[model samples]
Target: MNPTIELLNSHRSIRKYKSQPLPPGALESFIKAGQAASSSNHVQACSVIRVQDPSKRAQLAHLAGDQAYIEQAAEFLVFCADMKRNTEAAASTGIEPTLGMTEQLIVATVDVALFAQNVAIAAESEALGIVYIGGIRNNPSAISELLNLPEQVYPVFGMCIGYPDHQPEVKPRLPLEAVLMQDSYQEHEQAEQVAYYDQQMSEYYQARTGGNKTSNWSQSMAPMFGGKLRPHMRDFLIAQGFTMK
Candidate 1:
């Protein structure tokens, strides 16, 4: 495989990080690389907030399920889906641009995700460790207020970047046969595929945790699907001016 493919496959979430700061201008370079990612209609409806203040970081850490890595990482950033800039730019012209469309929300959210992934890849390429913190959505409103975000903007997620203090084994992924389909959406053999994959995952978890974690992929997903996960997200997005009309 090519070097890029190798790097992509070897990606791991780094929880513990060293105290060393990033090389000068590294963060800027990563952000710039993120900007290079494709956007819907080139809207580039995404923004990043670097949380440098210790007090704010501590509060954010608590809000995001007490993930201390948010405060401990050399750099922490909140990636936001921002349509405010586009709205203002459009208002500058003669037409009254529409707002609160579902498509608009989707575009902005997708843009933010793509941009953040690019930032992650760039950071990883530089031998830096990073972890995406989706827990920021746990209290999106509080985080938005803390970041001074305005309407037409919402926090999508946060990312932590720093030198690695520990190396974790790269997690295994679903088999190609289970995920990659033919010309159409085929599922005739899904049960068999999933069963096989589950066994593989069970073995992986067992080895990784020294038999402490015996749960497989299907079993581990119980909590996520058992109930309405993050039910507040709908109302929060609407309040942020993403009315999903």
Candidate 2:
């Protein structure tokens, strides 16, 4: 495999990080790479907030389920799906811009995700480790207020980036056959593929946790699917002007 493919495959979420700060210009370079990511119709509806305040980081850490790495990481950033910029830009040109269309929401959300992933790949290339903190969505309102975000902008997720203090084993993923299909959707093949994947994941969990975690992939996903996971998100997004039409 090429060096880029090797780097991509070796990715691991590094929770523990060193105290060392990033090299000068590194963060900017990574963000530049993120800006280069493709956007829907070139709208580029994304904005990233770099949280540098110690107290704010502490509060964010608490708000995001007390993920200490938010405070500990060398850099913590909140990636936001921002439609306000685009809407205002359009209004300046004398057009009455629409506020909250479902398609607009989708475009902004997908744009930010693509932008952040580009930043991740760039950071990884520089030997920095990163872990995405979706916990920010736990209290998106509080975080939004904390960050002084305006209407038509919402925090999609946060990311912690820093030099790794420890290396971890790369977690296994579902087999290629399960996800990559030819011609069309392969619904009939899923049960067998998932069953095989479940066993593989069960073994991976067992070894990773020294038998303490015996659950498989399907079992582990129970909490997310079984409950109304982050049910407030819909209301919060609506309040942020993304009414989903």
Candidate 3:
């Protein structure tokens, strides 16, 4: 594999970070690199907030399921899917702009994901460790209020970047055959493949955690399917001006 592919394949989430801060301008450089990612119709409907204040970081950590890494990481960022700026820019042309189309929500969310992935890859190439925090959505309204996010803008996720204190083994992924379909969708042996993958994951967890974790992939996914996860999100998004049409 080439250098980029090798880097991408070896990516691992780093939760334990060192006390050292990032080099000066490192965060800015990564964000600039992220901006190079493709945007929908050049809408660029994404914004990132760097959380440097200790108090704010602590609050964010609490909001994000008490993920202490938010406070411990050298740099913490909240990536927001923002349509406010673009809508305002369009409305400045003496015409009313649409506020909350479902497609608009999809575009903004995809834009932010693409932009943040670029930043993640850039930071990894620079030897910085990074972890994405989706728990920010556990209490979206609180997080938005804490960051003072405006309508037509919502926090999609958060990211923590810093030097790694512990090197973790890369987690395994499903086989390509299980995920990559051909010209048309088919699931001939998907169940068998998933079962095998589950076995692999079960062993992986045991090895990675020194026999502390014994759950397989299916078991790990139980909580997500067990109940209505984050039921407040729909109402929260609607209140934030993303009515999903």
| TM-score of each candidate structure, all chains considered together | 0.98, 0.99, 0.98
Error of 1 at 119 (Å): 0.6
lDDT of 2 by residue, 99-169 (tens): 89999999999999999999999999999999999999999999999999999999999999999999889
- Cα deviation at 186, candidate 3, in Å, is 1.6
* C-alpha positional error of residue 91 in candidate 1 after TM-score superposition, expressed in Å: 0.5
Off by over 4 Å in 2: none
lDDT of 1 by residue, 4-101 (tens): 99999999999999999999999999999999999999999999999999999999999999999999999999999999999999999877989999
> Best candidate, lDDT-wise?
2
Clashes of each: 0, 0, 0
Query: What is candidate 3's local distance difference test score?
Result: 0.95
Worst 10 residues of 3 by lDDT: 180-189
Clash list (residue pairs), candidate 3: none
Candidate 1 positional error at 88, Å = 0.6
Candidate 3 lDDT, tens digit per residue, 1-245? 79999999989999999999999999999999989999999999899999999999999999999999999999999999999999999999999997899999999999999999999999999998999999999999999999999999999999999999999999999988888898977678798888999999999999998999989998988999999999999999999999998
